[model samples]
Target: MKLLTLNFLTCAIKACKSSPASFPLHPRDVELEIVESDINLPFLKNILPRLMWAELRTIAAELGLPELPETAPTRDHLVEGKEEAKEGEEVDEVPSQTARDLHRVLLETTVKEGKLVCGNCAHEYKVMEGVPNFLLPGHLV
Candidate 1:
């Protein structure tokens, strides 16, 4: 699989396994926190086979964040694959994601420093220097 996809899956799984108190993180000017605790099955059905709904819900509950409700809100409100509206020199696209989009999302998308975990694959990714420290041990290999 592609590195990004593998990484995202592994991290998501780790988040689901670790204790919330031990979540690793990178603090920014505005701070970073997982917002949703509840999971809306209707909203999640279309994401992909890789997303573990059970894991996601478990992680959210652990973090004390609530997930979205089953109903209400517009369709695709919580879906990924949405692209940036602009395409100019000021903002460049990086593969599937734009540089600005990636930057904004990446900063908000770090595992907690000491207690980081993934909700999908249950793989752990440490956070160091305000960045995710994703190093895989040889056991899985």
Candidate 2:
């Protein structure tokens, strides 16, 4: 799955629900794939408000991906006063860099194989072929 989807996932253990420590399940031994796709600025902007910035940053860093900003840009920052253009540069380009970064990190990148382990419960959820297996064993359900 995209790193974006992993942001909202948590340990599947029923007793672990609603615990902050269980969330942002840590990706371990990840295999990454980057496949180019059309960039959708509007979709990136829409999801910015819902992302957990700090967790994303940490995970991305752990996986050796390009660094995202320590905090997500405010909506104002996304559409604010334009960037200063050099003689040959686009005036609005700098401001959209954040969106571009988000698009790359959250959309273009995928985890082809890995395990997402809960920090609190130490439960592991396997990811295969870019799909995370969040199913709990019958006993744990």
Candidate 3:
């Protein structure tokens, strides 16, 4: 999973600076898109070297989601990082993952108000007061 960081205060400041109606739960300054895929080792191999796990974990925890596992998941494998368990508590590999799984996790699990993260670029979109801040100001890391 591409780790992204959205500084709540920075996001809020940017949002409010652009518009007075911006708020934490109703953010109106960002937009996000989650990409689902089937690529395994190759995909992760390509991006893993570019991310900062610390940044990624911060985003996940802020959203009240479980953290990814400590050991790196082997390619083509789905290790339920951390989320609500189903009746079976098990699902297909392709359907459950971070780096190789789809990015719709956030969109599908909640209302249209919260933080959004890109699974590829690791970009973080802050959604407050029903708005998402997709703006990247400097140092496109």
Candidate 4:
């Protein structure tokens, strides 16, 4: 699963819904892979508001990736040189270093194999072949 997708996932157990800990399910014994693709700056800008920055930082730290900034970056920080645009002529917006780093972490990083453990329930959700199995057994459901 892409780290981007993991940002939106929560614990599958119905009982864990009310817990703050359920979101940002922690990775354990992970086998990570980098699946590179073209970065979409617009998509990054659009999704900035929805990211759980602290949780993402924690996940990155857990996976032994580089540390994130103390605060979440604003959408404006994702692109460079808006001021350079002329009155009528459109200027190309270049992705900033911040944007590139964000793209690397969120889009390129993949969990090839791992267990996502819920902080609330301590339930382990297996991830295999870059796909997370979120389905719960009948009792968990």
Candidate 2 lDDT over residue span 45-91, tens digit each: 67777888999998899889888777787654554244343455444
lDDT of each: 0.36, 0.79, 0.42, 0.89
In model 3, the Cα lDDT at residue 9 comes to 33
List, residue by residue over 4-56, the lDDT tens digit for candidate 4.
88788999888898999898899999999999999899999999999989999
Order the candidates by lDDT, highest first.
Answer: 4, 2, 3, 1
Give the higher-TM-score candidate: 1 or 2: 2
* Lowest lDDT block of 10, candidate 2: 76-85
Pull out the clashing pairs in model 2.
1-130
Span of ten consecutive residues with least summed lDDT in model 1: 22-31
- Report model 3's TM-score to 2 decimal places: 0.35
TM-score ranking, best first: 4, 2, 3, 1
Q: Candidate 3 vs. truth: CA RMSD?
A: 11.8
Higher-scoring candidate on TM-score, 2 or 4: 4
lDDT of 3 by residue, 1-141 (tens): 122223233332343445422322222223333444444534454544444445544445555456655544443343343245456665444434464332333223333454654433334566665445666766355
Report how far residue 31 has shifted in candidate 2, in Å.
0.5
Clash totals for all models, in order?
Answer: 32, 1, 15, 0
Cα RMSD for candidates in order:
12.4, 4.2, 11.8, 2.6
Q: lDDT: which is higher, 3 or 4?
A: 4
